[model samples]
Target chain A: MKAPSLQNTLLVTGLFTASFAQAAELEITVENLTRGIAFTPILIAAHDMESHLFVTGEMASTELQAMAEGGDISGLEMVATSVAADMATNPAGGLLMPAMSTTTMLSTEQMNTQLSLVAMLLPTNDGFVGLDSWTIPETPGTYSVYLNAYDAGTEANDEVRGSGTPGEAGMPVPPPLENVIGMNGTGVAASITNDKVHIHPGNIGDAEIDGGSSDIQNTVHRWLNPVAKVTVVVSE
Target chain B: MTIRLLRMSVATALLIMLAACSDDNDDSVTEVPEEPEMRTFEVSVFNLSANQPLSPIAVIASDGGMLWHTGEAASDGLEALAEGGDNSVLIGADSTLGSTSGDAPLGAGESEMLTLSLEAGSETSISVASMLVNTNDAFSGITGVDLTTWAVGETKTYLPAVYDAGTEENTEMAGTIPGPADGGEGVSEGREALDAVTMHSGVVTADDGLPDSVLDSSHRFANPVMKIIISRVE
Candidate 1:
């Protein structure tokens, strides 16, 4: 009986060491590739395979809505903690400007093998750049992934000045964006057409600044797909 | 306890034998210097836009030269190719080890394949470019794509982004475009608002309030205007 018990203890210890061997240190850099748009505080997390920050064609969770609509990540942080995910929040310290980049280091646990990131696009209602769950490669190397803008589908992209609350109808004009955005706009859309998260139909802003259908500038604020670039280096 | 001890000894002996076998195999497989050989690559470009006709495709393989860089002034060769649909200057560049050009303009939803061959010893890279002939200087391409590790039969696909040459403004005027939209002149020597290359902020057609534009809603396009597939055939 004593011999069997000792062998069991050895087996458990071996398994524990093997699981710790799978741990990895990751250096992640997120770059805002747009020429004019800015990204709100970014949330980078390494969670389990089943977890996701936001999924396309699926209704967004309330936490995703807060981040997409108001650039708030507190709710997401709580969710991450509940799932035992490794996360680095607000690595940019503030809004990441156009053509600027931010880097963060994340030490991931054995089960946390997937990565995700999200940040709101200022001057647009409920529009956020997102990376759904991407499986982290087991090999030690550098990899890059491009991100696209997605609409939370919780608010109308009215393109007018309004609140950032989840159910708002207009864009949140942060101080840095105040001078660049136009005013006295009628509004672009009245209701959400797609009730699930979907790829953003690029902003249809007008050239008129004082009065137009949208308060966003057509030439300055418009962007194509792949608005952000995320590079991840996996190291043991 | 005696059985466990015997089992551990057998496992250690097996591990040592496995290590010895691997070492012997490594010694037998010595590294050999690679000889310079002619390598052939097939590049295919597909137009994915609604009404934008792609200029004749230019495919080039070189050591490490880039056709154009963002935030930098366009090269004279790049300027002529972007403004006009003529790829002669780029195809005839000094840095290109091998180059090829499509026979004619590729219409929307059409594709063209061209082949290039280069002697391979040093690191090699490929570049591909084509102009959206309806616009002023909008072009889509991929530059400095490494082909060092690509297998002979392996193929890769890319959705390239559009760029503005900045040599000519996107006026969308009657005599500014070179395609069927306007049968206008090509390659003006004027430098306008921005003299450096940048990602194209899409064309604002006449239906979108650009009253002077000769383009209509059909001319508008989004990102990833072209699909490129590269394969090493030889």
Candidate 2:
């Protein structure tokens, strides 16, 4: 909401020009804090002050839907490039396992003052952990920020095995994650309550491995807020 | 520049010449000096969950180091404290500079104050942890929180998130929970379900989808389980 004001100042003021001309060097580390949830290929972007990958309470873009549904960042990368964003994509090289961390050194170009990040959560139809347009601190120091899971609100969370393509109905059963996941479930919710992006209500998994409404195990798939922790060390 | 350098040297010389502790073996005790002032801190904690009573809170001040890490396994002291409503082992941890504990367990919506004292000018960090008595191996606390900025009579408050001890599975069984709701066994030897400490996934009571769970909907809880307020009393 406040991005335009920041951009206008950057355009009009000589004072802002001095500070906005130089790029910022950041050592970014993302840690998956969940016990059982695995994060798919991650995307980190440093975009212009007005740009955002996903905004809460707003409709999910087609690019966002693709990533949330299938753990694909190609669409979102196009959006970032269109906005002249500096990005580091999939630094972990693959899906980030639980309680694991990945570090990426990214430099934000001039006027790219805001940093945003997104990564799909495996075994979920459209759930992804996200950080939306956080203003990069100017002072050189180490800072910690926590992230929450957001639902794309485009597809129904069927909680069953199905396709990962956008507009698909069920969750994508990635082969590596299948060992911890259950099988032969019925389904969870057929539709969503809030259509716009919103906080995920977490997974409503059941214990029945052979046949249950949700194929995901309740104790294994569930998570609380601040699902991921990001430590950003700005070295000027 | 010369004057400024001389002034700085004089100040350093005075500071170096000043004796913090006098030698007791000396024949004459030159005006027996009193002990250095102590920094007293009052740590206040309030339980905000639905029905989860907190074990006796452990309020500690340390020079450095962390209370816990996200991916690391819980210490035996932490396991004992999280699984049961016991804080003795954690309070006795070697890293603690000074620590205190509440006399009784703090119930839901209740508040308690714990106090700790340390010699002044000791670079200190604050840490407080307490078990959620209703759950299995779930504890809420803070770690390596910098409270050295507070002056005497100043207080800083914090909201701490709940952490799974990762020492036991959150089965929500009748015979596993230790609170008044179940009055079940507390602190088993080894019932770890996960590798390390992480945020609690919240209680999935019977009312929610887990039909076999002993917990009801009333037993459910969310993050920010405790509000901790720390004050430098002296």
Task: Indicate which candidate wins on lDDT.
Answer: 1
Q: Give the CAPRI class of candidate 2.
A: incorrect
* Model 1: CAPRI class: incorrect
Model 1 lDDT per residue over A78-148, tens place: 99889999999999999999999999999999889889999999878888998888878778999999988
**TM-score against native, each model:** 0.52, 0.51
Candidate 1, residue B167: Cα displacement in angstroms equals 31
lDDT of 2: 0.81
TM-score of 2: 0.51
TM-score of 1: 0.52
Alpha carbon lDDT of each predicted model? 0.83, 0.81
Local accuracy of candidate 1 as per-residue lDDT tens digits, B1-234: 222354477579989999988877454676888967877787877676656788999997877878899999988878888889888998788888778988899876556667778786768789999888989998999999988887798888887888999999899999999988898878986787779999998888774688999986446666666778788877
Candidate 1: Cα lDDT at B11: 72
Candidate 2 at residue B148, lDDT? 67
Worst 10 residues of 2 chain B by lDDT: B1-10
The lowest-lDDT stretch of 10 consecutive residues in candidate 1 chain A is: A192-201
Candidate 2 per-residue C-alpha lDDT over A1-236 given as tens digits, one digit per residue, 9 for 90 to 100: 58999887767786765657457999999999998888999999998877899965457899999999999999999999999999999999998999999999999887888999999997787989999988888889999999887778778777888878999788887888878777787887676644666556567778887778777888788888889999999995
